[model samples]
Target: MAFDIYDFTSLTSSIHEGLATFLPPVGVLIAEWLLVGISVLLFVAVFGLILVYLERKVCALFQQRLGPMRVGKWGLLQTIADFIKLLMKELITPNKADKFLYNLAPFIVIIVTFMAIAAIPFAKGLQAIDFDIGVLYVSSVSSLGVIGVLLAGWSSNNKYSLIGAMRSGAQIISYELSVGMSLITMIILAGSMQISEIIQAQSTGWFIFTGHIPAVIAFIVFLIAGTAETNRGPFDLAEAESELTAGFHTEYSGIKFAFFFLAEYVNLFIVSAMATVLFLGGWMPFHVGSLDGFNAVMDFIPPIFWFFGKVMFVIFLIMWFKWTFPRLRIDQILTLEWKYLLPVNLLNILLMTLIVLMGWHF
Candidate 1:
């Protein structure tokens, strides 16, 4: 087979075959599992630092102020310094907190993030696990993080923490419907839940363009719902610093707190990645009909870059929402979802179904 640096399939297959040649079948399985675990751990650690730095810079740009100039060139090492500090700090638990559940919450939250990340396709054949029900698998796993939030808050024995956790649970539960309906709308259009197949269906053109108005609506709803699901700002009633201090993880300190912090940025990445795969065509290069020259130029860029470029664009939009909007009142947040987004999302789903039935979509 011809080598393509952009596609990871050949590299991964060769590794597997080479290992099989020297190792027993069980040993091969064990080796692959070890490799995957280490890769995920390393990626999470490095990407978490990058995202924290990116968020600082992005927020600085919005506010017209310098960010992170003291640590390294342009303060690039700031997050790494902070990470090291967190690692050295003490993991403090509240004296009154339930020790077992309190300690378990952060692990639960971060583990769910890793599980959801496994299903996302970073590039061709680069995914850790590819289930037929990839979308459903992701949705189910990602939603479990809220349980950890609740556990942290309730186990802390703090009223503020409990309130924040309760708020997060309600917020995530409500907005999840909008997120699912948006994906279902696309699934109706694409006719597959497998993430790879969904991307392949966009070989000619992205669904956002081909599916037209309904696709646009679903995209909007998905972004809004995704932000809410991640407990991010504008919908961050759960983490109202003025009202609830540090919210659900208030009692957590040191590396435990870092886990929660890391999970937030990683969750942000996952949400953007899902948006990219569903509406922005995953790793597929952009193409305009009958423009072979332009299409060929686009294809010259690696698929992995296309995938991450789209992911970063969507991440910026989510970050913009975070920095720009005022946090909504808890009631307003719930009302926005139940009254406005949810109803519009339900209608949008029906519209997409009709479009599919009538063959109106490209």
Candidate 2:
């Protein structure tokens, strides 16, 4: 029972062994599964609320307005108030809408957002599921949100919803190409798609630095592509109220509308987390070469701090774009994707390949 590394290891081994046997039992397994499901649901719900509040505050700072200060301390309870309002609102469906699909679409979108979290590495030895192709798994699962958006838009049987869905589909598909290619470059350098391995590889030197010029280019491309992929800010054509009258979920109301709103912010969080893993060194501590004192000082901070700092930086940038820029025309959006991001990302990948082959990393 003495405090030692082996003692901790033995405890973990014993727990794992016990779970291996216990999980096969009918009653215990069902209870454990329910507990896990509840935990995930609660986490998503809380995170969605916090993200909404954070986005509002961040935007207000940029625009020089007081954001939600009337509710709770510093508007801490703003999301809670909004939740109450949404809960009390009457559910409305368009007369011509297909009830089943319209009703199901929001849930599908929200569920897919939750599923994407399964592959994200929150901290050392902390993840819901660790698959071999972790990055690819995340990409595949996250993209399914588009299907829900398209379903919501088309099934609503409204002209605006249909157009929003079509715009969203095109936007996601186009941006996914650059996002995938940029992530692949990191996978190439790390030689693995597992999130933990990617973070481990960055211990000596983050890929953003080790991968050099090509990595920098890929990072920029990934940020732009990720923004577009989530249908956020300048790329938020899907919800362009001015043009599409609330876009894909225009016909949705009450709790169903809340689902779409929650899904959008959750998707934003996922993309930001992914970017931190790929380019900003995930949970790795800051290290300056040959500066042992500085490195040691930095290591005192918890790994989760590094992770959140990076995520927040990206979130702030997204908010800046949202408040500062006008929404792009659909045609201009497509043109920006095909004419710029695709070609630049392709060349950047080729450059990374050459750099890797030449063994130029320090």
Candidate 3:
């Protein structure tokens, strides 16, 4: 039988039927859930390693230095080595630390990331969960990571950790408004929050191109705010090494530390994937108007590749911000969100509303 790579739902349905052939209904359901959980976990682990390697190389390129060249053929195994090292390290809890919350913090952070990942559409029918309000779901779910960060800091009983976590809370809280406003702007233009429907709406052209200036503004704002939301560099005041000595997770070690580390990269992926879906048209091939021949060629490249290509491009842009810019002081970070991004985002939303109402957007 010829395989149709584009029809992910068919593949998943076949698996469901196969499971049901022998197992009872409840057993099938449990089996499917277990499979999904395992698949997502594996994807997270592998993707985290790839992102770490990618970041190292990206940072090296920006600084004109070679990175991780000695480990397994262009340093392909460097991340794996690091993972093993982290696994073997000691898990230490300070005597004064609040043991329960301290241990639970990293799990909360990582689990939140996994939950957000479930909503993202990697390719056609490849999404884990297709909520009617996917945009709202992702935005709301991703913001909960701050609770874990706060817990890690307060429970650690370390002053520097507490200060760092406080900065993170303030940073995420301030930028989250901009992130929501930017998404709201696009949600206005798109008219529906369903991820698949939004992609289908872009069959003519991506929102970034068709919605023009307002769409462009929202995309830019989303990128900026998303970076802050992920607690990435420049906005990474949460883990500002120079100021707070490893920040909120300072007291965590071994796999606990690895959980915090892996969550960071996976969150970065989620942000990039969200940007791709909202602006670039998730899994949609690039098509130039009135150019059927060119578009047909693009269609041959496969939707999954198109999705990942756009995701990687956005990831590169975020990484560029990290390597090119100086880390902002916490005050400056808050000021950028409150004094600048928030006001512009408000006006942008209003403009988008007008555009949608007037049918000004193509």
Candidate 4:
């Protein structure tokens, strides 16, 4: 049978239907759900490795040095070697640590990231889960990682760990407002919180184009706040290695440490994916009404390609910030969020409201 790359739901439905013919109904259902989970897990694992390598290469390029080149073809297998080393390392806990919470934090972080990416559509009709309030659901679930961070810090019985966790909590809570408000500016314009629907609304033009300057401003705020929300530098006060000695996860080690490490990159993926879906147009190719040939050429590239292209671009932007900017002081981070981002986001939303009401978009 011919496959339609864009009609992902249809393909999955077909597979489920075919399996149901041989397998018991319960087995088919279980298999389908399990496959979905496995696919997402694999994506997270692979993306985490790729992101680590990419960041190293980017940092090397900026610093005029060689990155991982000996492990595999151009150091492609370097992350794999590092993963093996991390996987075999010891899982240590402090003598006075609260065992339960200290052990559970990393799992919580990983689970939240898995839940978040499920709501994000990679291609048309390709999300693992669908909800009317996709935006709200993703935001709420993703923010719950802070609980794990706080627990990890507090349960470690280390004053430094506690300090790091508190800083993380403050930073995430502060920046998330900017992230949500910035996204909402475009959501208000899109008039739907369903992520796929949001992308569909951008068929003629992306929010970055349709909503114009307000959309551009919203994207910038989201990028900055989203970076902070992920505990990434220059907003990486939570895990300030120079200050707190690895932040909330300082007391964590081994496979447990790997979980926290993976979650950080996965969180980065979540924000970048959301940016693609919300502002840059998820799975939507660039098109111009006046350029039939150009639009046709773009259509040939496929939706999945468009999705990843935009996501990678945003990820690169985040990495650039991490490498180029100096880490902000805790006060400076809060000041940037509360004083600048929050106010600008509020005004951007207002401007979007006016533009939407006036039907200014094409």
Give the best candidate by lDDT: 1
Error of 3 at 151 (Å): 0.4
Give the per-residue Cα lDDT of candidate 3 at 74.
93
TM-score of every prediction relative to native: 0.98, 0.93, 0.98, 0.98
lDDT of residue 7 for candidate 2: 23
> Which runs of model 2 end up more than 4 angstroms from their true locations?
1-32
Cα distance off (Å), candidate 2, residue 174: 1.0
Candidate 1 regions with alpha-carbon error over 4 angstroms: 1-3
Worst 10 residues of 1 by lDDT: 1-10
Predicted candidate 2 versus true structure: per-residue lDDT over 1-362, tens digit per residue: 22232123444345455666756667656665665577678878898899999989988888898888989999999999999899999999899888899999999999998889877776665566778899999999999999999999999999999999999999999888988999998888888998888988998877888898988898888888899988987999988989999999999888999999998888888999998898888878888899999999888776777888888888777778788888999999999999998888788878888888899876
In model 3, the runs with Cα more than 4 Å from the true position are none
For candidate 1, lDDT tens digit of each residue in 5-55?
Answer: 688999899889988999999999999999988999898999889999999
Q: Tens-digit lDDT track for model 3 on 1-362?
A: 32467758777888888999999999999998899899899999999999999999999999999889999999999999999999999999998999999999999999999999898887787888999999999999999999999999999999989998999999998888998998888888778999999898898899999899999999999999999999999888889899889999998999999999999999999999999999999899999998999999999987999999999999999999999989999889988988999999999999989888999887
Looking at candidate 2, what is the lDDT of residue 193?
93
TM-score of model 3 (CA atoms): 0.98
Local distance difference test scores for all models:
0.94, 0.85, 0.92, 0.91
The RMSD of every model to the true structure, in order and in angstroms, is: 1.1, 2.8, 1.0, 1.1
Q: What value does the lDDT take at residue 352 in candidate 3?
A: 88
